[model samples]
Target: MRAAICDDQPQALEELKKMLLRIPAVKKVHTYSDMNNFWATLKDGAYYDVVFMDIDWKQDETGIDFAGRLQEACPYTKIIYVTAYTLDYVEDVFLNHANLSGLLKKPVNQEQLERNLEKILREQSEAEGKLLIYYQGSHIAIPLQDILFLESRLHKSCIVLKKQEYLCNEKLETLKGQLDGRFLNCHKSYMVNMSYIREFRGREILLEENHVIPVSKARAKEAKERFFEYMSARM
Candidate 1:
């Protein structure tokens, strides 16, 4: 992941940069002692996946204020606050901004940094709703929430996403395991993502895009029970 870091202290900036470089997931990192330079680089179309910003500094605008502007420029960029101040002093302001990924205390160790980075990256991936699926010679990340259902076609699997059907080599059981609680095995040959369910007509389930899937007689009772439970949790 491409990253950017800004801290007024030169030693702190170097330490943070060294720690980030050790992380295998971090592809590139840009460090700045001046917030203006950092902001200017981002504004010039420099792409960064994550940014480690220090909140407390003797600057005109604090990191919290800069974060708000960063959100306006790149809403998808993840901002992790590295602050010496207590969260009590920052939480109120931090809560106002979206895409606030993590809050780390000063003198952070390698373990703490790794743990926070793992959580932030995982949450970022999930928030994007992408699911990794591998096919014959290639792999792809399909948006889980956008998938309507999966159908078993002979020896191939058909993923009903949006209004498109893509073929996969995996079976129904494999797909079910890869998916989260949002998908239900409504039939022996079909699995439906609950988020796309529009209605249930007897043994047939209506999904988004006017798609219909069958609910086996034996599984009908269990399906309804589970679906109701899912809806209840959402409510």
Candidate 2:
């Protein structure tokens, strides 16, 4: 996996980078002393699978704020906060709307770093499959990772994606049977891809692309429980 490290402390940044390089799973590692340089690299179309961010920036902007902006530009990039103030900033980091993968305490431990990396890699592997459906006149195979949610519409199910939708002549229950744990049946008529969920607002779920999915009153509690379980497993 390709990775980036953003930290103002030179020694800390290099230490993290060196540890990351030692991991065989990590193919490339980039270090940045300034947040501007990191943003500039992203703007230039550079992509990293994960970014190790420092929560406390000495400047006017904090890492949490910068991470929010980074999510806007690259929604798929996973963020891992590396900080000494884990207790102080932990709440804020999770509260923010970012694709957070995990967190690491400062003066990083090699074992903890590897565990986080392995969890992400395992998730990516699990997400590597396709949903085959007959759409229009041809058969379509949509990557499971790209799907946002599935909505039941009368006799058909609408497979919603980031930029496209497909009508499949299958019942929501039948489709749900084929999906993995990452897909949650939050409502009787809706099954959401947990990876695309931005927030859970009681009766409604806010998706990454600004789409909203209703949560049935009866299933709201289960949805919240499953979502938290999913998050905890990854962390």
Candidate 3:
């Protein structure tokens, strides 16, 4: 999808961009360090499928103002508010807009970026979340939003997640397609959803759900890229 990230923090913006590269499907990702550049791009009719805005930027216009203007300009493009400070009336602020995708708390992490990301992208994907898992004697439908990561162990595969793991015979490739870009291949044997990710240490990726998945020696770069793209869209 075509998307943009708008924030003032260079380090944070760079980190967000880095994570998004892991996904092979992202067509375009534009990063803006401040609102002026971003607003100019929008004024020039540059639209994105999604836009991530840092709510507390020092721009003359706040993210809320930009979002409202964006709603008037491009109603279809999803608006996601990114904030470092805790917001009390997030819903009220969103109500004035046309259609809001969702919000992200700042110092944005992978999982947080991904959680509501697929939620917004679900409609954008040609095929909305179609991940079908056969587990516990029934075909358990795993929404892209609920997934953590899929782990391959030896000849078999294990699904690691927050609530529970459903043993399945499905291959990662097939499931990955159903996922769209919300989940990515971080390791040869491991596929992860960016929404559940917390932090990516040298080899270990922490999940907000508290599970730790190892980034394989061969897949570390791809893993990092996945995180970057995901966070970039999050802003």
Estimate TM-scores for all models.
Answer: 0.53, 0.57, 0.49
Q: Candidate 3: which stretches are off by over 4 Å?
A: 88-92, 126-235
lDDT of 2 by residue, 109-157 (tens): 9999999999888866665587656676555678888899999998678
Q: In order, what lDDT does every prediction score? A: 0.79, 0.85, 0.71
The best candidate in terms of lDDT: 2
Tens digit per residue, CA lDDT, model 1, 1-235: 7788988989998999999999999889899999879867765457677888888889688888878787666555678888888555465555765467777888968898888789877865674556555554455778888788889888558988886778875555545545789988999899899988888889989987888899999999999898989999999
Backbone clash total, candidate 2: 0
> What lDDT does candidate 1 reach at residue 23?
96
Query: What lDDT tens digits, residue by residue, belong to model 3 across residues 1-235?
Result: 7778888888877777776655555578899986778878766547676888777767576778778877655545678777877466476566665467877786777777776667766765643564555565554556667778887665345777678886665445434445567777777777888887878888988887788878888888877887898899999
Residue runs of model 2 more than 4 Å from their true location after superposition:
129-141, 144-235
Comparing 1 and 3 on TM-score, the stronger one: 1
Report lDDT (Cα) of residue 128, candidate 1.
58
What is the number of backbone collisions in each predicted candidate, taken in the order shown?
Answer: 0, 0, 15
Higher-ranked by lDDT: 1 or 2: 2
Query: Could you tell me which residue pairs clash in candidate 2?
Result: none
